[model samples]
Target: MSQAEASQLLGLAGKYRPYPEYKGAGVEWVGDVPEHWRVGRLGSFGYFIAGCGFPHEDQGRQDEIYPFYKVSDTNHVGNEKYLSKADNYVSKDIASKLGARICSAGDYVSQGRGCVAWKQEANSYSGNSDNKCDTHG
Candidate 1:
């Protein structure tokens, strides 16, 4: 598995079409939001976690029980905005040895490092990311 430099992982969100229906957001910065959508500080919902080091030697076993995603996994053909697959996988044993945790089915995984993760939150965690990732719990 190849690792992308943290610097190379920073990305701007692509443009999305306006929601079909809208309602007042009651917030100045965001004038309106899709109907039925809740607007609140993202922190109120979940925490951003730090990525752990995944040694190259423990990567690439398709027989493993978990998928190990690298920043580049974000760019995989089917993962334009969400990770659908990974080039590498790991067993629970290897993940435990690396002090890594797997984000559950709905959790978010990003390429941002600790210092910039919060700032990238708004752009990083939006859709339902079905794929779990190995991170430091």
Candidate 2:
């Protein structure tokens, strides 16, 4: 989606009225935030993780026993409480080896390459390199 559209969908489009009082946030790019809200770097809240990736053959159409996310999934993420769809799946045995980077519910994922997009997983899931992207809890 275009930046403006994404902003509106993500509720960052200034739909809410401005706070009565405001102070400089110091960063020009981030002029100000709601007066009551404290400002801090995202890192202050959590660490960034580069997810692990499996081989190409390990991903593709399969039984839905375990969901696997990819960059495309971000386009479908909206106001939903959790991400509900994925393009790939794996068997329990494959999942066992891919456990190191299994995305837990509530984790935010962002693509690292082409067609970058982000999504917050609604449930436990997994992904490979294309979607191995960045993640933060």
Candidate 3:
């Protein structure tokens, strides 16, 4: 993945073209989109569950029963598609006490800021990042 290779890859992506006609998307960042496509807020399509606080000492334990997602877990590359694995874990009781928001079946998760790496899980899970995540149910 050299700079030239990266540039060439991005250049290849630039080959994609939009439909001939376009209209404003309302938001400043999203200037225009295909007229046929309708734009809406991300919150409109799904229920967002904000993360909550949890003691760090209870995290990073492999023996725990429930996975405890933290900011660091986002660093794992393969998990960008789905959160099948986590670097930290917590017990069911601990999670319940922390009131950590759990993702329902088919829910999607992503970081609140920075490079948004959205991923959906096949099953339910919990998080302890304290407002660093946006979980869609």
Candidate 4:
């Protein structure tokens, strides 16, 4: 409800509390990080794995093992901060044939392009989506 309330829940979710101290990170996008946190190049932390392009014809199938998530899936009832629901699914054969990537568990799914990114963890990410649940970890 409030900023303070959100911060309190952060602790229960294994989130680290903000450092009492503060300083500019020198990177415009990064803005301010923990006072003691180190600043590095864009890829210094990790790299982004862009997702494939999924045509409309290739989506909306539910007869598969791998889940195909879209950006909208992030708002799913149970997704919250984790992606456990999807509107589409595809079999291994279909995924492989289309050159889709099946991300491993714990991977952070994010938007392919945007000023602010929505990150979420999903069991598996497969196929190209207009919503673009690209993996970054």
Candidate No. with top lDDT = 4
Q: Clashes in model 2: which pairs?
A: 83-122
Query: Local error of candidate 3 at 54, Å?
Result: 2.7
- In the range 1-137, model 4's lDDT, one tens digit per residue, is 43346567765433665569777878665566667877777677777666665657868887667776666676778876667787777677766776677776777666653111122335533333345567766
- Order the candidates by TM-score, highest first — what do you get? 3, 4, 2, 1
lDDT of 3: 0.59
Greater TM-score among 3 and 4 belongs to: 3
Question: What tens-digit string does per-residue lDDT give for candidate 1 at 18-128?
Answer: 457888778765666679898788666667565567667876677776666666566667666645566677767776787666665445555542111111112233232
Q: Which candidate is the best by TM-score?
A: 3
> What is residue 17's positional error in candidate 1, in angstroms?
9.3
Q: lDDT, candidate 4, residue 49?
A: 67
- Please identify which of the two predictions, 1 or 3, would achieve the higher TM-score against the true structure: 3
Q: Write one digit per residue (lDDT tens) for candidate 2, span 35-132.
A: 67777787898777664565578777556465665566655655233456766676666756765355556666565642212233355333335544
Query: Candidate 1 — which pairs collide?
Result: none
Error of 1 at 125 (Å): 6.8
lDDT of each: 0.53, 0.56, 0.59, 0.61
lDDT for 41 in candidate 3 is 89
- By summed lDDT, which 10 consecutive residues of candidate 2 come out lowest? 113-122
Q: For model 4, how many clashes?
A: 1
TM-score of 1: 0.53
Please provide TM-scores, in order, for all candidate models, with all chains considered together.
0.53, 0.59, 0.65, 0.65
Tell me the deviation in Å of residue 6 in model 1: 29
Q: On a 0 to 100 scale, what is the lDDT of residue 63 in model 4?
A: 68
Ranking by lDDT, best first?
4, 3, 2, 1
